[model samples]
Target: MALLDNGVWSKRFFSGGWTDSALDHPVVEPATGDLLGMVGLATAEDVNRAAARAAEAQRDWAAASPQRRAAVLRRAGELFTEHAAEIEDWLVREAGSVRAKAGFEVGLALGECFECAALPTHPQGEVLTSEDARWSLSRRRPAGVVSVIAPFNFPLILGLRSVAPALALGNAVLLKPDPRTAVSGGVVIARVFEEAGLPPGVLHLLPGDASVGQAVVEAPEVRVVSFTGSTPVGRAIGEQAGRLLKRAHLELGGNNALVVLPGADVHKAASAGAFGSYLHQGQICMTTGRHIVHESLLEEYTAALAAKAEALPVGDPAREDVALGPLIDRRQLERVHAIVTESVAAGATVAAGGEVSGSGYRATVLSGLSTDMPAWREEIFGPVAPVLGFSTVEEAARIVNDCEYGLSVGILGDVGTAMKLADRIDSGKVHINEQTVSDEPNAPFGGVKASGTGSRFGGAAANIDAFTETQWVTVRPDIADYPF
Candidate 1:
């Protein structure tokens, strides 16, 4: 097996230091049955040290002028563009994302850096001078150490997006990347930040699995915990954060619903769903796992969607022609397969894709879905689509809103009606005449209800809160009220 080790950066170069070894996990290439590498694990002590270093660094880094801080972020953006192809290759090899998806993710990361760089220039402070010689001013200050926990699906972009805003806003960061894709993606990030001249101890990369994450969250030095992962895991992190009383920002699993109206373009909706649902093997949290198709077009839409799923070419993710690929690992593949198979056995129709080979499973489509079925209730993080037919818009809305998970939902109909219904959906994001993959960095992306807490990638207001705290200043000057 190839041995991929942790990469730590300091003073514009790799520190040649290693995180404390707590064991190791094997990284595997799912399609070829080849072992990619093994990564050294990090213990609770390592987390504590990283967090303390970040806190210590934040004092000086936050003192820098906004323009100076933004310059570093902007420099990182340029570096990302210069190494786009190299970054994309790492993404494909490590995360098993299709070439196109990996490219898109890289571009998104570059754009996010530019967005975050511009955040500091926004006029924040307010100064007031009164006849009574009273003065007041308010400003935002960095929150010191922040611990970032990333998911494997979009390892590079999702994780670094949080890191960018936190760092650009003057907060030092300790990033705990997902073990599945940590080697290539997280290492690339560390290298780029070092090249951009980030100060030592300001940014640290911790490579490990779930236990490492728990250590980071429990550390007192870690003032903030920003996590992206499954809903259950997010909940666990939230509970731990509550016990520690540290700020927690979570982006969790989404069983996104798509409503196809009677007058909708059944062909268009089916095609969109087929491509959207199976992207990254449907490991994406915002993927459309549940379909609420109109009863009138149920047969036609279901058949069309099944055909689309069958037509998709699944192979190695590194190839440009391959449209779909295997799930990240055996555990994920087994979990997703079990959910679909059990749903079918519980009276849900298996419209397509019931076979599995090795870690690769066929892109599946299920029709005649009942609310009681596992496919309907669970967030099957795989390329399986279960569709329930609805008679009217109200019925579709009811079915879509019934779920406790509501991160995103799509409306497949005339733009006017879709927009109207989008307002009622109990989800963090709504797509009109589009799929769930259409995410904009300027818009706030997150969930409602049990999906998650707080938000990411909206604008300065949404992200500023992630890394900064407000300070209130007041001066009496010469005259003061004597009410007290």
Candidate 2:
């Protein structure tokens, strides 16, 4: 409620404190198309300053005892839970998330904090057998400073997912949240850690647009860059990081597929598909963009799915009964509508809903899709599910792998058959009898091929290595034994 002071929000944090900029961008609520407030934009110079401070703080923070670091993170998790109500409200207003989605995002953020707090005590090194009479051990060392660039949708969780782990691993973090949800993503995150007694300059949140994000990525002080967003942006970041020889971790876009086998329960699969495709208005990277059903069950599954999609309540997020909220902004709304219209013209059938009402669009089901359609090949980050019929499991696998994105896939059928087919699917994750939109704090979450850059973000092992470098140490009992 007090996120904006006098209709303006600050962009600087931690080392820089609350600083203003020459230009400010308006923050708009998607549900009503109203301007909530304005957030100051950070310049490239500000990014350099934050990165420098983070590098400086990281040395002392890394040298501190693991218990000390864990204590701060645990306290931050507690603070996050204590302010859940305000954070939820901020998420609804900033990201256009419904109550359920907003609450889930906040809960996930807190869970990440707690989970990452335990990383310090976890196994971060190993003792290796050496040929010589010396002790050889490999340990993980912090990468000095880490830069995290989060997207607009689910900003709170995604931002914290990378930030928490990097900090827990002894690296100072510089978080640049999406301009759309700066309050929920950047401000709230910084406040939680600051209140938890985190040392000054250990964490910094810079709220701005693409320019600021690029600045962070190009900054020499930032040794590791973790980003979650569209694939085009991720690719650019990966290329830039490679050119600069900096470590990059990217969680990019996905065109996930949900396969309904012949023996699958049509009604159950339909419900799961509806939730997977429409949750958060289908803005998630793991949203089910394609629905491939066996030819024998295509009619039954399509009808059931259309009914479920048609029944979802779409309106302002503030309404308790509203099951779906608007897109992030007018541009997203227009782009979604255009995708549906173009697909329909290309011989795709709109099975359920296709019209855009208010700032929100209806949950739509499209059938009779061809591989040539844009919706079939591209990632449709909207509440639209395209159903395609496959003659066999082999055909289904082909259809699923035809696209460039292979983030995740859901299989609804016999466990044995699903597991067998999952091995052939070119995805990073496979869910049996479940939806594609699934994630856990302790599981390795990422994608392969074009969906991502093959860099994982979750799980203790993955997080620790993602933000750290390996160092090998050897000790000899006698100095004369060494070749001096």
Candidate 3:
């Protein structure tokens, strides 16, 4: 495959249509600094048009039979399966994911589409009967216009995780994908909606930068905003939506922690911890940025983890042997660099891998970290793993809960010991014997505290709550005759 130059954008699909125009940012391979292709940039007018089209199509789409909606969603899953290789290629090229990581994300996306399709049957209503010649019932109705704003990390899967559920519930969708990987994966998803024989305008893909997104959020027609990204941007989107009195579902930033206890399998825990933090170069919201090690085991545990991190293949993301990839852009690289620099100034020791090569930063490990260091206090959002020493399991658990952001936490130790610690951590999700990466299409995923508001990607049950509104029907003919 030939690498592309800067100034060329590829539009896989859009509201107006597919147009491969030159985008603003040149798609560059992180490790090699090789240009791949340009991503399409959507303008404010584009958002307006997309929102209008979705609103126009929503009435009919919401009225479509549940069975029919489910069939479309099923077909989408099949289409995704058939095009798995192509999608994986795009993920590697655009998002800089290793082949294994790309494959995992694609598989998750397919599963989400399938799970979302089955939601119609799962969205059940409640029935009530009254003795005084009156009856009541409640049903879930579509939320009309749903605007899905996705992050770049898991471009395809996370994007679909939000939009698929909305579409399956008979809502018209306007998709605003991450600008970095906006071309093929997102376009392919919109194409799936089209292939499923969805009416025109039922699903609109507007790929662009921040201006386009701000416009989409401000549009009067877009009633609900589903967003995933950093805390600052998520807060801005929430404030904008609040101005319009619109509904918002946000899954924002995380500073996940991995606690290693004295009784834990040092080797097993070290390997899992390395991958959880360094995979995707630590761009994941659920990535374990903090390693809270028991004081008794801190030295040996850090050594084991440093070796595992050193052994990871840090080469081309497209290669099957590679386990780590480059930071998406220079901005992320700088952010990681600043956090590491600040930690060192605060007296944290760099244990391993803290160098920057081209767009990729070395998988970093820091020890002797104090709670006051920026790396310990904030979401590093990089491969810099900072280890903090803790005297007791209670202290370890307390340190994890002290962060303003409580998204996910990983506890590694004996089954009984881990569970006991887990009972005290104030995070949205907890993992035992592993890093904080658990997969259950039916499970709820989100954060608490400053991690942002609400939740998303939960199974059919929770999605039913997100995409639908409840209406209570009543029969009170006798009450009409009597005034208050």
Best candidate (score: TM-score): 2
Candidate 3 wrong stretches, greater than 4 Å: 1-13, 19-25, 129-132, 476-484
Q: Candidate 1 has what TM-score?
A: 0.93
Alpha-carbon error at 338 in model 3, in Å? 2.3
Model 2: weakest 10-residue lDDT segment is 3-12
Q: Candidate 1, residues 240-271: lDDT per residue as tens digits?
A: 99999998999898888988887888889998
- Best model per lDDT: 2
Encode model 2's per-residue lDDT on 1-484: one tens digit a residue.
4433433345334344666676677778888878877777778888898888888988999998999999988998998888888889888977999999988987888889999999877888899999988899999999899999999999899999999999998999989989888888888888788778788898987877678888999989999999999999999999999999998998999999999988899999999999999999999999999999999999999999999998998899876578889999889999999999999999999999998978989999999999889878889899999999999778888998998998989999889888878988999899999999988888899999888876477898889879889999998898745466
The CA lDDT at 230 in model 2 is 93
Model 3 clash tally, residue pairs: 4
Runs in model 1 with CA error above 4 Å?
1-23, 127-133, 479-484
Question: Clashes in model 2: which pairs?
Answer: none
lDDT, model 3 = 0.81
Winner on TM-score (2 vs 3): 2
The per-candidate count of clashes, in order, stands at 0, 0, 4
